[model samples]
Target: MAFAANTALISSPTLFTPSKFSSSRLYLSVPYKTTKFQLYCKPSSSLPLTSLFCLRKKEKSVLSALSDDFPAVLDEIEGNSGWDVAVEGEEGEGGFVVQPPEEAKVYVGNLPFDVDNGRLGQLFGQAGVVELAEVIYDRITGRSRGFGFVTMATVEEAEKAVELFSRYDMDGRFLTVNIAAPRGSQPERAPREPGHRIYVGNLAWSVDTGRLEELFSEHGAIVSVRVVSDRETGRSRGFGFVEMSTESEMNDAISSLDGEILDGRPIKVNAALERQTRGRF
Candidate 1:
């Protein structure tokens, strides 16, 4: 007696041949008509294999979409399990090297004052190749600004860094790690008004009042965009206040901009509190 096999591939599909395994179970994703189902099968001579046929479809694997590294990346991650371990090192040495402009960059905050370029590179290098690591500092005081940027070799590496370090407590502070916004892309600032207002926090340093107003203007009429800056340096405080033309506009701005990424930072948008009227009382 003889048996026949029929297979149809519609899109990207993975098929396991019975000849590959003599006595083991193989799992496959089989698509039929418009439905998809999982198939667990073991081929044996006694059983009719006609029902084990499959119609294949061409589609990119989810894993492939994530990164071309695929299974190899898994091994890399496992091998670097000791990345977070701290080692004794010198301080304030191995100054930062500027990386060529790249999209795969991450922001790191809440760093210890003593952390230098070398220390930061060691910590983030665990995830992937460290193209550059720089600690922001005040030009006048020559002191660390308590935050910095890390540029990875690839987007995959940058994502891995964020997953490994975001909100991870190091030393005595919890770190805030996120994608870095492109340089020079600032937020717009609006003028303070008598109407409704909101508070926006975690803004990127590059963002200015004009950009902030432009972003919030989509929700409603923005009365003003005031990004609080330091009196001495005039740098952004990483937070700002916004006022809208009306209460409805304010609410709309809150709903739209909250949790949205602006200049690679996830901003916090909420209603502003009223100033206490102590003198009147």
Candidate 2:
């Protein structure tokens, strides 16, 4: 089959033969309008295969007209593999809050304390469109913890952002960006020093301080267990805290059951830091 500079050719299995002349070249004999012609040379090379195909000037014009549709064909090829090619500023409505598509990449780690959505968008948008930026905050003080997420619009952009900004510095601190691992993929955290409380979530509706103590007491002596509940309703909110006698025991407990699904729901178990109480409520 003959092809132009930007043209691609598809050949039937029997009609295509590997070239004995060069590894990158192929030979094809095509029958068109009662005449047969032999084609040779590399279709991928800079020279167009027209030199061998005997296409007249008029026929070349038709081929040129067909070339206009190549991008759309290529777009279809890209679409089949979980990629969507989009032009700049044309992404649909809704800002960063939208969940990044499964193919989208995310970044994590320390960020500037004052960083906002716009700044984050500008920083990551350089690599690719930034779909979202969020800074986790302390519940009480509402202060940024110098960490946040930046979700890129596409996998390629996400990968590019990670490569370009993983160690880029802002406000005198180095940033950490990478393909965000799926949630709960992080390794179990080592237990904190003694006296640290463990945050427990996804408790069964019937769970309470006594049940929590009973469950966690197997690992070590339980200092205390408190199931946080709604102040007005007195119903369990499905979270609690447990203080172990030693950090080693806490480590064992967390390692054994941090994400263990119990009673149809996966539990979130982690070392809980001391709660900062800023003035009594």
Candidate 3:
């Protein structure tokens, strides 16, 4: 069977024998791109197969014409999958996309602060050719985020890297290595809104960002934690900001954790304010 376009291919496409569909020709009234779908067609004895099948824009036109003339082709194709052709730039909705088993990218998590982009690629090179390595960094602090991504030449190399370096100790931290999810695959986080930031007063002098995260994490997903410090002294100023993912989480932390005893100090939690003297209460 002759295909209209090369890019329009089905998943596990079958090569139809020339003896079967020697004159099989398909005409899609669509403009540029033809979408993917399986074509199940067999010649009928009573009414011979037409040399060409044309699918049109109007539903009634195609249905009425095919039902009257080429019933077999119309019934099988439409019943299995509908015509989802695309214009020059428009993308068609649901159809089987032929893709490889796994992506060539690997996620490397819990990395040490010392690891750089080059070193990460060198480490993954033991498995195969490392195409690219990237260590994520905190944009504001300009510090290593302790996690990065490594891209190999092929999916097989990525799988090999995962087996060799998963839980592999670097310095002291055991690495978390696995195939990375495709871009835009994960659900996007909700945007932060007003009242999402929480202010905690009377915090212990030792209470820092990490410590504050451990305490309030049980309430909801946290955006960031900052234990405010004096300009001169590096010590925590007994107050900080805990940015939650949403306003409800901020309210919950305030109601549940306010006055909670920590390091012999009862902490106060409230909505963060923009005013400088807001923490006076």
Q: Write the per-residue lDDT of candidate 1 for residues 1-281, one digit (tens) a residue.
A: 12224212122234444545333233344432221222222233222333232333334332111223333433432343211111111233222323445569899986766688889999999999998899998687676766899999888899999999986756634577888877797645344336587999999999976688678878865545667778788788888887776788788889888999999999999998866445662
lDDT rank, highest first? 3, 1, 2
Q: Decide which is better by TM-score, 2 or 3.
A: 3
Question: Taking the tens digit of each residue's C-alpha lDDT, what string does model 2 give over 115-199?
Answer: 8767887888889787787777656546565577877777888888888887676753467676766676775544544465789
- Superposed Cα deviation of residue 174, candidate 2 (Å): 0.3
Ranking by TM-score: 3, 1, 2
Worst 10 residues of 2 by lDDT: 55-64
TM-score of 3: 0.35
lDDT of 3 by residue, 68-175 (tens): 334455554445343333322112333343233348899998677769999999999999988889999876567676799998888999999999998786764468
List TM-scores for all candidates, in order: 0.34, 0.32, 0.35
Deviating ranges (above 4 Å) for candidate 2 = 1-99, 184-281
Deviation of model 2 at 231, angstroms: 20
- Candidates 1 and 3 compared by lDDT, better number: 3
Error of 3 at 250 (Å): 30
